[model samples]
Target: MLGRVLEEIEVNVLASQAWELYRTLQLAKFIGEELPNVIEKIDVIQGDGGVGTILNIIFPPGTPGFSSYKEKFTKVDDKKRVKETEVVEGGYLDFGFSLFRVRLEIIEKGEESCITGSTIEYEVKEDAAAATNANASSMVSIQPLVMIMEAASNYLMNLKNNKNKM
Candidate 1:
């Protein structure tokens, strides 16, 4: 089974400003600092926030099933303001998912506004048991990504507001 979930939020900031955060590992750090309950920690295993970068992400202890997973940055397009990552080990793979990938994009809307989009693409193992495949399909969700985008939008807006006060 193949599945995808997409969510987007508009932020009152320039696309370049939003991309400054989303285009690199700073977004991971922001998530760790802002959403402690959703993500416990993220450690860089290799690369420097660019294509081929590997990240080992750890979920909070009480997370429903998997605790951690390693993902690799498969695409980092600066001109397009997009980044894509794929799970290379653990996490959803253990639940019978053959492929789990995430793509984040910053779309320019206006001089002072932009849209932050998050997408999750996954495929369940074709030869896996029915239950496992069913379970894998069930695990696909956009809530977590939605939360991240909302938080990031708020954070960037706050920063802009504070800077304007100076």
Candidate 2:
């Protein structure tokens, strides 16, 4: 059976800012720089941070049930603040999934807040559906990403606040 999952998190940040961060690869760069404990590094394997861009994400040591993975951008819409990426190598490919794709969208709630929505779609190999389903279920829990986004939002807001104070 094909497995599909979708999740979303609301953030106290602007949609334009979130879209810029996703489209320009600044989000990955920021996480790699500020949250080494969560993500060790992010390397661009190809493309220019747009559709068809390939990225290698390395998880920090001791990160449970995860390591490095390669993902290719399938779609990126700046106007809509949406991005779709597929795990072409590593990650769940080792878990019997024949296909794995993730879509992220940032929807504006107001001038200062937005929603980060993520959709996960995958297909499991025959005879391995059960195990793959279990694994995919765990992967669908995107708490790490939410945490990273929250940290980044707070950092940027604080920076802006400090500048205003100055």
Candidate 3:
């Protein structure tokens, strides 16, 4: 598999109903003037035939990308443990700065809640020879992705919960 391709995606559980928190964590790695480079911003735009979506993650110095994917917003079954949404985001950031294909899913226990569960699958199926930044990804490091998923899901659930309250 060396030279051909090695695909890896890690999954984990995030705090219940917390998307903004996850977003903050996602950007933390790119801040503080440390590491090989930095990440400035991430603009995630996702929407497609109720299945397709777009996510634009921007980096420092003006490197940005637009990713599109098909998503299924539902549960694993009828008696779903949670509500969920999944999207695949893939693209390049400044040639060698970044290149990856990621599948992200967020889940919540209820209809309108902040967040509860999440998963992130990222892999550089094809990294250029010049690209040196290895994909140091794990279900641990990508806790933020999961965290956001939980939050988003919970947010939806909470919205429903609030309506019931009203």
Index of the highest-TM-score prediction: 1
Candidate 2 worst ten-residue window by lDDT: 131-140
Each model's lDDT: 0.92, 0.79, 0.35
lDDT by residue for model 2 over 4-94, one digit each (tens)? Answer: 7666767676788667776678877888988898889999999888889999999998887669889999998887888899998988787
Worst 10 contiguous positions by lDDT, candidate 1: 129-138
Per-prediction backbone clash count:
0, 0, 26
Q: Model 2: what TM-score?
A: 0.83
Q: Return the top candidate by lDDT.
A: 1
Which is superior by lDDT, 2 or 3? Answer: 2
TM-scores, all models, native as reference? 0.96, 0.83, 0.35
Q: After superposition, how far is residue 82 of candidate 2 from its true place, in Å?
A: 0.1
lDDT of 1 by residue, 36-64 (tens): 99899999999999999999999999898
TM-score-superior candidate, 1 or 3: 1
Per-residue lDDT, model 2, residue 4, is 75
Model 3 TM-score (2 dp)? 0.35
lDDT of 3 by residue, 1-166 (tens): 0111222222232323333333332323333222222334434354421223334444455433332223333232222333334333333332232323333223453543322333433333345322545543321144434444334444445655686799
